[model samples]
Target chain A: MILVLVETDAQGATLVSREALTFARETAARLGDQPVHAAVVAPLEESMATLVMKQLGEQGVAVVHTADDERLTTYAAAAHAAAVVDAVRAEQARMLVAAGTPRGNEVLAHVATRLEVAMAANVVAVDSVEPLVVTRQVLGGSALEEMRLDDAVAVLSVAGHACDPEPAEVPTAPERLGYTPSVTDQDLVARVARTEVTVVDDTAALTGARVVVGAGRGAGGPDGFKDLLELTELLGGALGVSRVVTSLGWRPHHEQVGQTGSRIAPDLYVPCGISGAIQHWAGCQSAKTILAINTDRDAPMVTKAHYAVIGDLHEIVPAINEELRRRK
Target chain B: MANVLVCVKRVPDTAGEVLLSADGLSVDARHVGYTVSPHEECAVELATQVAEATGGRATVLSVGSEDAVEQLRNALAVGCADGVLVEADADLLGPADVAAAVAGVVREREAGGLSYDLVLLGNDAADTGDFQVPVRLAYALGRPVLTGISTCEVQDDRLLARGDGPDGTEVFELPLPAVVAVMEGGVSPRYPSIPGRMKAKRAPVETVALTAARQGSGRVRLKLPPSQPSSVEILGEGPEAAPAVVDLLTRIGVVGR
Candidate 1:
């Protein structure tokens, strides 16, 4: 059997989780239709649980397991790993999968350590299930490494944007199992004391936005972002900045996109005045289309972009905004 | 006083172009220079700060070939008091074996009455991209582990860690004898002075051989990703490009024509 750890947001299962489910469904088919189970570490609130189960069933999960408890509302890494290890044992799963998000990788790392098993993280492709051959990105997504799992139980995390989420043609009504694992004080040693939400507009989330307008050091200063913000507003998108901009105190770190910042996979990424470093490109390379606007023609961003405009962003942004306004 | 251990790896400087080896097992390091990964540089700095603030000692450790002593000395030049080299070919050791070696070192030190109050590591190594060693070592030692931490403080009797979440910064508090994988951007790592480098050159480094059984991750080979086809069409120069940019945006459906 194969097990997948499903991560849910406030509404329901996240896109990355669905992507993992989609990958799991295909992997299971490749392994002669091995049974695939989905597990969630949450409180199992009735309505949220129902929605999540329905979604997983639609994704062709054969069984759904929930480690429901009030304390699990906020993630405790050790506790979640304990629950996952128990689920893996109960399902007799040979392979376990999760998204390569921060939480997903962290939780699965705990599981791997607790089980003393091998985990292949940021895996982009799964070649086989028996020997567990997989391809993962390395060197900040600049290169790929093929690895095989030599352990009895293999744990893997699918990289973000590796697979497109597709619903099953014929959905399965999954068997639901509710479990409550015993937690110890040691397990709660690194519990989250508090979480502060900074997002003012839901549509402005860097990762979820459809279009992102990026500013960098070339954007000049804090006042320089005013036109970019206007342009982002006109394009119905979000405003993103590079690390230098944030370091210079022109923008918040939350708006930075890079290896150390948010990784975004938007439909359209318009990077204005941004000279792309490898660290910055690692986050935005997944965009379907990239348009770079910069004065330096030799900038990495301009060379790698699908389209380029060699110009000053300060002058070009307001013009685009004006044109967009006229069209509206 | 607290005793802190910081784990570091020597990785090819990623600032330059990286080329893959012929067998695809590793990067070709003939022309490329090696240095500590960015995150681990911060980890060494943080360990030094914590040890200094708490009136303790900070030690650096590496599981790599003889050349890895260079990285260990780099840490020592910064602020680490001592260095330990677990003699092993880093290429031959997977995360499990690395963790086992570290755990072995920890046990040996503790047996010698040098119990570490805290263990520090980079969030993930730059080359292997393995996020397993710190957690695995923590589990082996039966201690608490926190990864991707940006800010850490040594309080009276506990360690406080803060990291950025999807929402905002998430705070974590753990007792001593904890393990933390620190991320970059938390603290600026300082460059070593001439005197510090000279002192580091004279520092005695303890060398230990790892007898742990090698548990391979079944790595097949390494390969460069297929380069994306680039056919960038320059629209125009200066402000004159605004109309073309708008047209292209319209064509891409980001704006209505």
Candidate 2:
């Protein structure tokens, strides 16, 4: 049995957590339909386990456990680690896996320390059975390093953005169970009063939108395009910024999509003025299609893109905006 | 008073584009120099400010090869009162193992009769780029953990913080003895001069807590990473490239004009 934990804030499971569930389900199927269980933590009143089951069941991993303990209002690294350690012990879980997200990596790492076992980070693929072989990316994705793990229980943090999100298909049988760990004075070290979740109340959202419009230093400092809010809203897509825009403080770091920022894998990724640095490419490489609009026809991002438009965005953008409004 | 602990990583300079040795993922000792990552610099910077404001001591800690000594030295240069090198020389562990290594330090430090009122760390190191250590260390130490912190301070009796959220920033106010991971570039770090750097080497740089990597591989060497990238060339046609450009533009919905 491989125990996987899904990290959800007050609103719902995070993007990377969903990917972890997908990874767990696919890995289980390959091993003659071995068991894969998903554990989630939510406020006692909320049915987070049920929420994960709805999504995980569709992918075949239906068994869901929720740590409804009162101590779990906000994510306490200790509390989460204690629960995972118990889950592994109870299931005699063969392996423990987590997404490479900040929270996932942290919680799993804490559990590994408690269990005194060796763990692998940034693993892309896994091959099981008697001393597992895991492939991990090193040197900024410039090289591949294959490592062998010889331990009773293998703990691995799947690289966040290096590998593609695996197919989410699970086995019919799910063994559902939940247990809480004995809290110590130490475990109560961190306290949470409340959690604030950001809801995309705006029309432009990355999840369901097909078109993604972005701006950068090329957008000319968030001022020239006084009607940008209108353009992106009309496109009915979320807005993203390049590293340069964020570095210059023209946009908040949250809006920057790259290896360090958000990894957006939408249907269409429009790169306006982005030169497509390797750091940025690793984040958007999984997108279905890429549309690059850069005056520099020789830009690296333009070459990797599905379609490249060679011209000044300053000259080209106004024309497009006019056409969009004319169509409306 | 806040007793903050910071874990720093010493990586070869990213901006230097330092040549790396091709074997076994080591940076060349000759050309490359190690320093605290920019993100960790912010962590130390914020800690120093908090100590100045609240009347407390900020300590920096690290775990790596003996090369980590240089990182500890760098941290000292930044105004960290003291430093520790875990001297763990092994392949980077997943977050779990790294946190454990840090916990060993906390336990040893705790024996010295000082418990931390807070812990600080960079959101992530640029090299490994793993944003897990701070939060995981908090978990191992049984402390409240906050990752990717944009803002933080200590109030009368509470710890206040702002961490990165989806659409906006989220504010957190907790009791003392919590953990906060500083977001990158949130604050500018201070520079240590020839005087500070030279003085810090002999300054109480302790190895109080060290988990020497389970004596596995003694091999040490680095391979140089490819330094050259494809250069840019203008396709010339200037505005005359418009015809071919318009077709490509219409394909991506950038034009109908």
Candidate 3:
């Protein structure tokens, strides 16, 4: 049996979780029809739970194990790890899969440490289950490493955009199990003190945006983003900045795109005045199409982009925005 | 006063193009220079600030080849007081081995009546991209651990850490004698000055051998990702390219023609 940890967002199961489910489904099929189970650590809110269950069922999960408790509402790594470990034991799962998101990776790390098992993270491909051959992203997605997990339970986290989420041809009704693992005072030692949610406008989130207009140090100053924002609005996308921009206090850190900030796989990414550092490239490398607008023709972003426009973005962005408006 | 231990890794500077070896077993470092990983640089900076504020000593540690002493000296030049080199083949050690070696150092120091109040490490190394050592070390030491922390403050006997979460910033309060895995961009690392470099060149880096058993994860091979074919087409220069950009956007379905 294979157990997958499914994490949900405000609306329902997130894209990364769905990706994990998809990965688990395919891996199970590859392993001669092994059963795939999903373990969710959440509050079990009626409607939310229903939505999650339906999604997991559609994804062909044989069983859905939910560790629903008041303390589980917020992320407590120890508590969540305990729940996953319990679920793994309950199902006698030989493989545990999770999304490579921050929470997914962190919680699974705790599980690995607690169980004293080996884990491979950011796995992009699974070769075989017998010896557990897998390919994982290393050096911040610059290279790939093939690894084999020799442990009894091969714990791994699939990289983002590794697989697409698809529903089963014939969906099955999954058996739902409510699991509550025993927790100790030591488990609560590193609990969340509080969470401050910064609500951005609906279209401003980098992950969900289909088009992203990126800015960098060449953006000059805070005022420089005005045209970029206009371009983003014109393109029906979000505004993303580089690490330097955020570090300079020109933009909020949340809007920064790099290794430390959001990793976006958008349909189109237009980087303006941004010299693509490897750290920044790690975030936007997954975009379907990249167009660089910069004055320097030899800039890394220019060389890496599919399309390049050589000019000052201050003049060029407004021109494009005006051209787009004129076409409209 | 708190005694902090900051773990740093010497990695190939990833700012330049990273090439793979012909054998595909390791990164081709013939052309690339080495530096402390960015996140670990920030960790050293944070440790320095924390020690300065609390009148404590910041000790930097690394488990790598003999040349890793250069990285330790760099850290000392930045602000660290002392350095320790756990002489080992970094390429042969997995996350578990690294954790065990670090745990051995911690135990040995504690035996010598020097107990660290806070242990700091990069959230993940840039080269290996392994997000394991900090948590594993914490587990080995039986200490609470926090990963991917961007902001941290020391308050009396406790520490406050903040990281980005799905919704917003998630804050964590950990008691003393805890482990923290710091992410980059928390603080800009300072460059080594002339006098600092001179002092660092003279600083003694205690070298020790790993008493812990080596752990292997059965790695098969390291391969470079297929080079993305990018044939950049110039859409013209200046404002005249605006129409071409619009046409391209429409072609990509980002806009309607």
Best by TM-score: 3
lDDT of 3 by residue, A135-239 (tens): 998888878899989887889999888878888777878898986776667877888889876645232278768899999998999888899999999998988
> What 10-residue stretch in candidate 3 chain A is worst by lDDT?
A196-205
Q: Classify candidate 1 by CAPRI docking class.
A: medium
**Structural similarity to truth (TM-score) of each candidate:** 0.95, 0.79, 0.96
lDDT of each: 0.86, 0.65, 0.87
- For residues A1-328, write the lDDT of model 1, one tens digit per residue: 8899998888698988899989988988898988889999867678988899899988999888888677777778888888899999887898899998888999999998878788999999987777778999888787788998878788999988888889988899999888877667688888788875654423227788889999998889888888899989888888888878876778776688876677788999999999998778878988999989999998989989988888889888887787777777
2 versus 3: better TM-score goes to? 3
Measured with C-alpha atoms, the lDDT of residue A46 in candidate 3 is 91
Model 1 clashing residue pairs (backbone): A148-B218, B24-B222
State each candidate's clash count.
2, 13, 0
lDDT by residue (tens digit), candidate 1, B137-227: 8988989999888879899879988877766778888798899999876777888999989889988899999899998756799888887
State the lDDT of candidate 2 residue by residue for B69-181, as single tens digits.
77777777767788877776536455556677888877877898877788888776655554556765765776677776766888866888876544345667777777788
State, as a TM-score between 0 and 1, how close model 3 is to the true structure.
0.96
Top lDDT hit: 3
